[model samples]
Target: MRDSLRFYLGDELREIRDVDPTLTVLDWLRLSERRLGTKEGCAEGDCGACTVVVGRLTEDSQGGKSVRYEAVNACIRFLATLDGCQLLTVEHLKGPDGALHPVQRALVEHHGSQCGFCTPGFVMSLFALYLNEDRPDERRIDDALAGNLCRCTGYAPIVQAARAMHDLGDRTADRFNDRAATAARLKALADEEILSVGSGDRRFLAPATSAQLAELLLGHPDATIVAGSTDVGLWVTKFQRVLSIVLYTGRVTELRRVADTGDALEIGAGATYSEAAPAIAALYPDFGELIRRIGAEQVRNMGTIGGNIANGSPIGDTPPALIAAGAALRLRRGDATRTLPLEEFFLAYGKQDRRPDEFVEAVILPKPAPGARFRAYKIAKRFDQDISAVCGAFRLSLDESGNVAGIRIAFGGMAGVPKRAAGAEAALIGQPWSEASVHAAMAALKADFTPLSDWRASAGYRAEVAANLLLRFHVETTDPATETRLVGDRRLAHA
Candidate 1:
């Protein structure tokens, strides 16, 4: 065991013994490091003013390890999770001779700054994008910058900068391209020793293996398990809640994998949305599209699908789709493990079937049956960086006679939990796949859920939208040429 944290801050090796388990990276950067370039806009993960780049060693399917860089919001990311990774801030971008990085240079040349408060965050985001993509189209550029908000109303120039950044210079010539050296440095910090450190009432324990995590969780059942910190970080910054015992699962290698078995897909509890998107997209295209809309690039880069399920938030965007796909949850307690249907895992709002000593191991999603049709819809006020008011998912399979043979419908934000719409499914099963059958299923939704009125949407609106989404799904699947989504070519018409 080691009572310290080890990571690379820029090219410098930082090995500190004294650390705060709940202290956010934003606070440490501005206070301890005196690096104010990374500003705090929302203090939550919504606004991307605190965005920074993190690089870590990632292993491919062939067991070849390389460094992968991604942009994350530092405001909600705890400092303890930085173990064995490289934390790069805006201040570290310039060369020793004070030459601006290509991203910064592009922003300056294209007049991407107005008030300049959010420029650093934009630079960091563009920096990560530049490192990862050799050429990013307009849609990709927009997706990369979705988390960032420019209050100065200067988005046109910023977008132009994103496009022109590649023309500035070759990305391979950048200092960060020395992947071998960075991977070696990160590998040096990797070890099986558990990290135990924190201030007075706050304690942090990071176990490198799943067995060790199970043992620690069994000993301290109440310990807060933090993987991405997209939601937990908000408790500290917005609510000012002090976490007593924090078990960092970000370091556990076993929980960060996504595997494709012959019959089912096994997604580790710590696998982020970005990591799992490709595999999901291949199986269910519509479901994969919903993942891109869950949050901006930063949130998707950090937030895990398992954390979304483990948190048991009814408004989470992934549950409805996963439940509709007939996924199952795996829980582990010490050496014992159990599997349960994902829908049954949620008991009620703010409550889950998870035991105090059990940890979410992985989510197993069986391959959709042959001829299965799946669709997921997220209804939010804004297209980006907004919580869902009502999310609905549908899976339908018709028999040779053109009647509904197997069907599963699930919804989020319509009830206390991510629930399967049993009544709706019953209304459609064995019925002809026609408008009458869809209407019956749509009407059955009211009996299945009585959603509450909230700021995002009203109870009546939720019910209406839920039904309309089912209708839209039917129309799209039945008539493949029909245009139901307005986001495709119609977006530019509004401009």
Candidate 2:
């Protein structure tokens, strides 16, 4: 067991001890390290002004370790979570001779900065993109920079900078390009020991394995388990809630696996949305599209599917989609484990069916049959980086006669929980897949949920949008080429 938190900040090895468990990465960077490159915009995960790239050792198919760089919101990310990883800030981008990196040079050349407060974040985000992809299209560029919001200089120049970064020079041949050494350092840091930092009520523990996590959870039942810290980070930044015990699940190896077991897709609870996206998109395209709109690229990189379900938020985007797909939850408590239907896990607002010692291990999504039609839609105020007002997911299976043999409907933001529309499903099952049947199901939706009004939308608007989303699902499934979405298809007519 180790009490000290060890990670690499730029090229320097840092061994930290006796620090507050809830200390955010942004604070540690700016205050402790005295680096002023990473700025704080919203203090929450919304604004990308605090964006920084993290490099973690990832094992490939051949059992070789390589560094995987991802941009994350430093303002919300806890400092304790940086154990066994490499932290890179905007200051680490310049060459040894003080020459600007390709990402920074491109931004300067394209006039991507105005007031320059948000420029560091934009550089880090684009640097991550530049490292990962050889060339990013319009969609990829938009997705990469979606988390960052610049009030002074519009996104047009930033978009141009992202497009022009690759053309500057050889992006891969840089100082941090020595993946083998970085991976070796990371591997050496992964000692497979339980990290217990801090004492008493204020504590942070990161277990290296699932068994260790299970034992720790059993010991400290009240400890808050955090996988990605996407939502939990807000409790400290926005709500200013002082967490007593924080048990981080990022180091638990088994919890990060994503596999297809022939029958169903088994996504480990710790798998980030970015890690699980390809497999999910392969199974259902529309569901993947909804994930793309979850909270921009930075959020997707840090947010986990299990955390999304375990948090039990009424507006969580994945729950409705997973419920519609007939997903199952695998939970663990010490040596004991159990499986339950995904919809049954959520009981009410801010309440889940999970015991304090029990943690969600995996989510099993059953593959739909050949005759199944699946669709998911999210109605939010803005197109990106916004919470959902109404999220609807549908799956319908037709028999030989084209009648609804079996159907499942789930919705979020319409009730206290991410619930299945039992009334709506009952109305559609055994009925023909036609316009009249869909209308009947839409009417039955009112009986299933009485949505509450909030600033994002009114109750009446929620009701109307929920019903129309169902109708839209019907229209989409009935006609293959309906062109229902307004913004999905993007093509550059002329530069």
Candidate 3:
């Protein structure tokens, strides 16, 4: 069966399969559908101008929640991957009898718009904020909208508008729950095969089964695997990569599940970070902020945790965290499958230890010790959406006497691939959590790595910071009295 685009547009549900898989949602919204509310400021995912609301089916404890809305940048999002989801635009933010949405009214009253071009995207982004959770903190608001960049009106009034959304307190009164209607339509749509779009050179293919997917890929090995297209979409808008053979994974349900076992937590490769993150964050609170900063709520909602892992960018926020947790990958081909450590999966720069015919199916993460101490840190130019200069994840277990029992330290943006600080780990393995031991282990920094002198940070700076971060971790965990929790103290008790 063929996959199709299923989303909400104003009062009606839109089913779109008329464009190539490589085409971005921004183009579809503006050109094909003529929905101008979603703007394109920076073609890349950076600027939030192409923000649009995407509605996804959620599984609630009660049963199933249909079409939950979120604001995402349409610019770097592939249109074909939106199958079995709902997409909303600013024009649809209405209550019964033409009542204005809270975000719209608040923005209007606060004069949050100066150029008016950015207003629609900002409003939609805020509306997604309004729908997902109520009474978000300042940090949450900033993180939720960080992908969006605006020049006019600064951010004060816009921030004011974000806060006002909570007080209105109404739960989308006019928002209809067309669960049966939407789900049935989507069900009917996905129950077809050999789906193709466009008449001329522009075309897309969304195969239903992995076999069919592989067959298409065999013919077009250069075909793009567009699950969420968060990164690849950037290639088109930012770099203008003309993708010829595009494959959509949203139709392949085999790659979108999360499962738990006694030994490991198994997550499908196509499972979005939004879907897989909460479970992971629960297991490791140290990664809460990291997952939230993976992108905005929209990107998280649209992007997959496995996609982030598969993309294998040094700046990817999830890889360090996963490596720290001792995650493994499940790869599959036409009929055979295999599993391997995720660390071994990355061979080198722009390379993976993957078979040409095999693609990642899922990732299995071993459960950490209940008493183990954990931390993941991303040092970037900006707190969100910015590439990391040095990303670190530290996991430590201590003996009763405060001697290190076991340790795993992983760093991203420090080498050609995400690497473990083997020297640092060896230094702390048998040593007590004493200052002198930590000081001695700092010497391992030189042996472990010689980081690149990138624009993010100098090589010497990276080495110093990496060493000190370990010492700081030791102090906080082993001797709280020695660590100053205060920010101004500058005693540096963080990693």
Model 1 segments more than 4 A misplaced: 483-495
1-495, model 2: which lDDT tens digit per residue?
899999999989999988788899999999998889999999989889999999997767676778999999999899999999999999999888999999999999999999999999999999999988999998899999999999999999999999999999676786777788899999989988999788676889999999999999999999988988898999999999999899999998788888889989999999999988889978887788889899978899999999999999999999999999999999999999999999999988999989999999999998877868788888887888999999999988888998999988999999999999899889988999999999999999899889999998999999999899889888877875663444445421100
Count of backbone collisions in candidate 3: 9
Worst 10 residues of 2 by lDDT: 486-495
| Sliding window of 10 residues with minimal summed lDDT for model 1 | 486-495
lDDT of each: 0.90, 0.90, 0.74
Q: Supply the TM-score for candidate 2.
A: 0.97
In model 3, where is the ten-residue run with the lowest total lDDT?
Answer: 486-495
Backbone clashes, each candidate: 0, 0, 9
Model 3 residue runs over 4 Å out of place are 1-8, 13-18, 62-65, 94-99, 166-169, 176-181, 192-194, 198-203, 209-220, 481-495
After aligning candidate 1 to the native by TM-score, how far in Å is the CA of 29 from where it should be?
A: 0.7
